[model samples]
Target: DIVKANSREPISNEGDIYALIACCETGAERLSGMMEEFGIDHLDDLADYIIDTSYRGTIEAIAELPKGTWRNVLKVDGYEQEIDLHAALTIAEDRVALDFTGTSGLSNKGINVPLNYATAYSVFALRCIIGPDIPNNAGSLAPFHVTGPKNCILNAQPPAPVAMRHTLGQMTPDLVYGCLSQALPDRVPAEGASCMYDLPLRHTPEAVSRGDEQFALELVFSGGTGARPGLDGLSATAFPSGVWGSQVETTEAVAPVLITRRELRPDSGGPGRTRGGLGQVIEMRSSDNADFMLFLSVERVLNPANGRFGGQAAAPGRIRISRDGPDLPGKGEVRVKAGETLIFETPGGGGFGPPRERDPDDIRRDLDEGLISRQAAHDIYGLEP
Candidate 1:
């Protein structure tokens, strides 16, 4: 019924419509089954119980926070130069408010973020660390209030280009954590590669004329996660995005490109008491006599993830035609010649504590596994290989 009501608009793509309907139907069926098992005779009663319980839990959680204002500023690789994302978190007994008054103004490019999207991520970050076990519903989210001055990057009005909003939106978690770390130092994690690496591939006109089976493809990849208080960061894991990396076989079956090499880079993770996660390297080339265009939008290029508690920063990321060639910027579109290969090195996570405090046995394990070079082991971890 919901899908039918939403089908008022003209359907330009039947496949997309079918997929949406399937997703909606699956969710509805699950909710109905849960209600039945719980013996929920009245939908209104269940709704009230959920809302009231979540609201009370949210209030109790907010009351635990120290009443004060904490501020943090983050720098991102903008269209032409660096842009700052400023956030001021104010905690009270009843609610929490995030203010972006001092953030940079909206860019002329497509990297601006809308107010609703910004607010959503801001609340999500808070919920992650505060009352994380609580059920997320309308009531649980009602205590968060996000605001930014008009014309700023976090509050861009209509007519502004926001095509790549996620480029900066995903950074909000790190930005918010900056403030929360001051209040709950033990609970927050170090900075990490928060944004996703998305690549769009399209066949060249010549390949199209040759009757290629697949003409377009999109491949998604992730970087390392920041180290935690007592554990090492996850290697090549998706953080805020919660998305899995695409399989090489899956991509090859749909695209006219061959993945030559895909593996973790040695010593990519930052060295510390609790080591950061490791990043990966990917190399690909177009099929014989077939050229393609690639679209790139990634972050942590200019300012890599920052470490915490005297730990070292993670390795920065890069993209290029070859290992020795000039590097490509974080966002742009380029053409790949038939025989030319494109290489991508994702960013690593930030360490949690001082490098010298790391366990020697763990360091030896990394060395034996070829995860770190002997020189890095001696210099970064101060250990003889």
Candidate 2:
């Protein structure tokens, strides 16, 4: 009966092949239906045409820029000290190359980036600056070439721990934008809180007694985006990572954590003609009387986001316990006692233009909306509250 249902099933085979045949038949039918619906007679010809068009568009995009080498150096808060991320972008008539020849050496921590991951972000950055409308594929990506020194932070060798690669990998867009900003001043935006603030929390043995089931939780949070040429940046928005913020209810339901407050921080955005996005303040505490482990791997602490075109740099990020204890480093694993509150203030984005060029009405609106404090309005924006 099974063989009869699948008409193309091999009669000589003793094993039941109905499921396998059905899957293959369904895939083949879908492909054939698509071809027929689109009236595709020559698949090879259509593929070739697509490749040729994409390649031409990519080349034309590169041809728009003047041939020159632009360089930028970015500093990241490493485990012990600051680490530098250097890039030299060379633009030619047909292609562009980014060489990470002078970046810092490999770290003894897990924050190192693999070459493939670095290249992916580098290509993404270039695409954001040039030919963003072009479809991303092999042909469209052919114009970009990225290389880095083998033992550097951007290209770690084997046997090196890279569990937290995205901590530094996501910074490539901001690093590359530093160079592109010099090439096309009007097109690029200022720096932003490029890295994500991810917290991985696991329950302790004591918490399992009060809970239904022991669970692991991951909470993702973003800082701010860089201000653009024509508009103010979005507050508490994800930049290059494109990740969504977690909901308070969703987090509370799965874990024994209480979210006390989550709101935008006042005076966190850099003031300029187009102001940068605002960072946020999040406060939480343990709901149950049980301690837990907190894994913190975040960035934009020591080195805040940089500004462009005579603008001011944004405020750096900070993490603390109850706002009274000592500030914690950007990356580490620590234990939190039960009922102890944790506070995280993310970094703000960099402004686009000079503060003097900012409109007075916008500054007034910022004061009215409580986005900026009265003191900051007077000190930074040169306005009276």
Candidate 3:
């Protein structure tokens, strides 16, 4: 029965099996070679030693947070109705556990996140907060356990329309960190634009059939990262994932789009002692006289990145057709007419500390660099006129 079920399993593409097998074989050869280079007789013993060392470090880091239970709940802008994501974290002397027993049920859309994906991000968040530089091997991961109900959004069952799993999966770090912020007050950074602002574009079938160039591609963009306890947030950065934003030159070389303008938005970052990172403004139109489609699924449009401690929330994102066109929804597909331009203003990160405590020099630097306007620097940062 098991063999039959495995054989009957659904696959997106037949090439996937070949790719997985190839990767597996390559990894095995590499691992064996590495073991030989280490002069290890048995792999089990070596694994044990590595795990033990990492475990010890994990225990030490876990000790920093006082033993206690911290809980956090936030709402997701689901397609139909609001979805809830609840985290109940329990930290003991030597270990930590996160439970998602109260997360919303599965969604009809493609945002459902499988357990493994959710677990991967959840563990990643804990590792980032607990020991960012520690080896993410089996030993290091042994100290943490994450759980969710079978049908919860974080643990979707099969056939749950999870093609866009990362849409929700990427938000785990922020969700998990919310609980940790309680235990380690000033340690964790504030909420950030967790998910990348991605634009998946493709030419219309008619355009492809004509003499126009045929192209289908994706361009990923980043927003500001949340400010840390003592440091200002980074501008135009992808937090948690740390993936690079797409370069304009690279996109122009392949995709059929003409970029009109791309720059950092002034005062987009929230104001605080250590200001949040600044988001960016991107404007583009179809290069050819052909209409194109853009499919977007991202956050930080309706709900801006929230600040930590006494900080302020960062700016929310916006998507729309040029000047007079109606504002586009955060999720869904939209068409860009041949001569029409599309504008996307990505969200900024939440600030750290109070706005009144910001340094005058930092505010001045932002103004000189055009990261923030002089008016905003004076108004928001309480700078002298």
Candidate 4:
């Protein structure tokens, strides 16, 4: 029902149905195999023990946190406008609550987030901070509660065009983390390029008329993670999502597009004591001068990830046509004409501390590996070659 309503294509749901059946069939086999290997019919007693232990551990961790209220706001580039997401968090002795009271109203665009989806991301971020080693079962998750206004972006009503909820949904971690950063300044990492850059590409109708093959391909990738208190951020890594990106080989094999370049952009990571992760630069074009269409929505173009503890903000993202062509907006469907290449530069994560505090050895290493330019080292890091 959801697939048909949003995509207006009933055929797409076949893949989901197949996966659902596959999981159910394979899941039973895996469970039986596990029981046979352990010489037990079920792990019910063990599950209870683990959940109890995890619950106690979670309680202890929550007790350690400073009890107070913290508020933070984040703005995202919606389809045609920017929308704010506000969060007020309160950590009590036994529980934690995140309230999205002042967040923007529902966007007619596909970016609205359902209440349940918003709660999932908000609580996940909290769990990562408290009881990170815990198994994160129902017991560990029981202490956190999330709520928002019914019409807010984070809790939109029906018919609000939530087909693209992930664009904003993926950002919930950052919004909640922003509040936590104020509570535990040293524990949290700086903001990062949080959303996945997934491009749904297809041959345009004109291309099909001109003999181009009909194909639809999805290429997903992500930017860097924020720099941690004691460590530099990861480059071209998927932070919040933890897993993203479709293989270049797979896309090339299934589609008529040539990926010309995929490399880390130097100096894209914010300069600081613990440098943020780097973003990627990708260049691609339709094969044999055939026109194509690309659908994408990404963040950090208008407002890059902000730094924590005096760290610097990351470089903004960019998407444009190659060969001195015009820049394109970050959202919506874009047409790619013949003789033009799509150049996309994902934004990096924010730095963690003051740039001067960075290790000189790390600076030398960055220069040796082409992570940062010599000029950036001299100017931004205040170091000479």
**TM-score rank order:** 4, 1, 2, 3
Backbone clash pairs in model 2 (N, Cα, C under 3 Å; residues 3+ apart or in different chains), count:
0
lDDT of 1 at 341: 87
Off by over 4 Å in 1: 1-41, 205-214
TM-score of 1: 0.90
lDDT of 2: 0.85
Which residue pairs of candidate 1 clash?
none
lDDT for each residue of candidate 3 in 1-385, tens digit (9 for 90 to 100): 0011213433233576789999999999998898899887677876788889998988888887789999998666666667789999999988899999899999898989998998898889888879877899988999899999998999999878898888788888889988999988778888888877888887776764575665667677889988998899999998777877888886786667889899998888888888889999999998877799899888878788888887899998889999778777778888889899999999898888888888899888888898888787777778997
Which 10-residue span in candidate 1 carries the lowest summed lDDT? 1-10
lDDT of each: 0.84, 0.85, 0.84, 0.85
TM-score of each: 0.90, 0.89, 0.88, 0.90
lDDT of 4 by residue, 1-385 (tens): 2121223454334787899999999999999998899899778898999888888888899999999999999987777788898999999998999999999998778889999988987888888888899998988988898999898999989878888888899898989989999999988989889888777887787654565577776677678888999998998888677765666776676677888899998988888899999999999988767788999888778888888888898887889989587767779899988778999889899999999889999999999999999998899888975
Model 3 earns a TM-score of: 0.88
What is the per-residue lDDT of model 2 for residues 198-226, given as tens digits with 9 covering 90 to 100?
87877666654665345576787789888
Which candidate do you rate higher for TM-score, 1 or 2? 1
True lDDT of residue 91, candidate 1? 93
